[model samples]
Target: MDKNVLFQKFVAFTAAVHQTTNEITKNVKSETITPLHYKILEYIAVSQPVTLSEISECMHMSMPNTSRELRKLSEKQFLEKVADDEDRRKHIIRLSKKGEAMMNESFQRIESRFIERMEHVSEEELKEIERALDLLHSKVFN
Candidate 1:
């Protein structure tokens, strides 16, 4: 196979995955919370006790914008700020119980949808997908 053709196929696969993810996440969004809000919650759930600056950097958002979003999440009772032990002046942000529940629910919904879709595939095909995904994960992250 030509390298260019392989690259095109890879791009197409990634785009499809991205579109599917967006569709799956649409159910997670609500009138009060946008997709970005859910993303922030997911990030905090995964990286608890994260500082505002760190979240801002990781999200590629400005400090003011991140602060505004954090404030909104706080008002929604999704997260809270705790004083850092080493630095009283610094605060660490963490997801609240409500946030955790929301995150878990969203994850379960997405997982169920994925499993439903994968049910059409044979075991051998599933194994091949798993292996390919593992390779892709390693290649992309490492």
Candidate 2:
């Protein structure tokens, strides 16, 4: 195995992901939202009523950074904080309806553009790539 070939592939993959992110975000032109904000929204939309600490832990972000993002998201009406019934001092973070709608719209628009680029790859090739990615992820993360 050529280390240089693997390194080049890694670089190319990272570049493509960043490029796609920029392209999709450029189309949206949302002044109130950033990529990190959208990522937070994606997480909260699926798992709502979760604590701030939980978000920080799952996202591997510091408490201050997560808190700051949460505050900005709340100000944008993208997230709502609910007082935990059991613990008055704790607040749960959840996506507002507005955030959910935005996320759905963004996903559809981005998916359409991305799908266009996938036309060249055969199903077998896609499966191989998926398996490769899973192996790489397990090696790096596990």
Candidate 3:
């Protein structure tokens, strides 16, 4: 296969995934959380004990903006901060019990919708998808 053609196909795949995520998350609403806030929470849920700089970089947000959002989440009792053992000046952020619960519920809804949409997939296809995703995560996206 041509490299340019493969790149185009990869772009197409990413676009489709983005659209699917938007559709799936459209119904996911929180009384106090916006899409941006959920994006932060989603990251922290997966990579807890991370630092402010890490969050800011990953979210493509400014330090002040990320801190502001973290403040809100803390106020809402959705996250906890602990002093980093190695760096007392830096705080490590993690989700509180409430935050974990919220993430689990939201993820369940999203997973259900995704599964419904992929109901036509066979076991072999699912395994292939899993392998593809693993490869993408470890190689392309790493």
Candidate 4:
């Protein structure tokens, strides 16, 4: 295959995935829950008791900005900050029950949308897409 054609196809695929994800996330966003808020929730949900610095690094955001978002989410009762036993100055953040429920609902919405879109695709084609995705993952990450 021509490398230029391959690159173009990859770019198109990435654009489509980004667009679909944005659309799904837009559907889930609320007054207190913007797309960025959902991203923060996702990071915290995966890494509970995480520190502010850790979240900042993971999100590729500055400490001040991360702190601001955390405060907003806390105000919304999505998460809470507790003093880290290891260090008095640093705090650990964890999602509240409300946060977990919200995250679960958002993920369910995205998954259901994906499933709805895939319903028209044949099983064999789905399997092939899965295999291709796995290959891409392995190539990119490993």
For model 4, how does the per-residue alpha-carbon lDDT over 28-56 read when each residue is reduced to its tens digit? 74556777888889889877879999999
Best-matching candidate per TM-score: 3
* Residue ranges of candidate 3 with Cα displaced over 4 Å: none
**lDDT computed for candidate 4:** 0.87
> Residue-wise lDDT of candidate 3 within 1-142, one digit each (tens)?
6999999999999999889889997767576798888999989988887889999999999999999999999999999999988879989999999999999988898889989988999999999999999999998888
lDDT of each candidate versus the true structure:
0.87, 0.82, 0.91, 0.87
**Candidate that would win on lDDT:** 3
Tens-digit lDDT string for candidate 2 (113-140): 7787677999998899889889977985
Tens digits of per-residue lDDT for model 1, 1-142: 7989989998999899889988776676445787789888888887787999999998899999999999999999989899999999999999889888888888888788889889899999999999998998898645
Off by over 4 Å in 2: 1-12, 29-36, 42-50, 53-68, 83-88
Q: Candidate 3 clashing pairs?
A: none
Q: What is the TM-score of each candidate against the true structure?
A: 0.80, 0.64, 0.93, 0.74
Instruction: Name model 1 segments beyond 4 Å from true.
Output: 1-10, 87-89
Candidate rank order under TM-score:
3, 1, 4, 2
lDDT of candidate 3 at residue 51, scale 0 to 100: 88
Clashing pairs in 1: none
Total backbone clashes of candidate 4, pairs 3 or more residues apart or in separate chains: 0
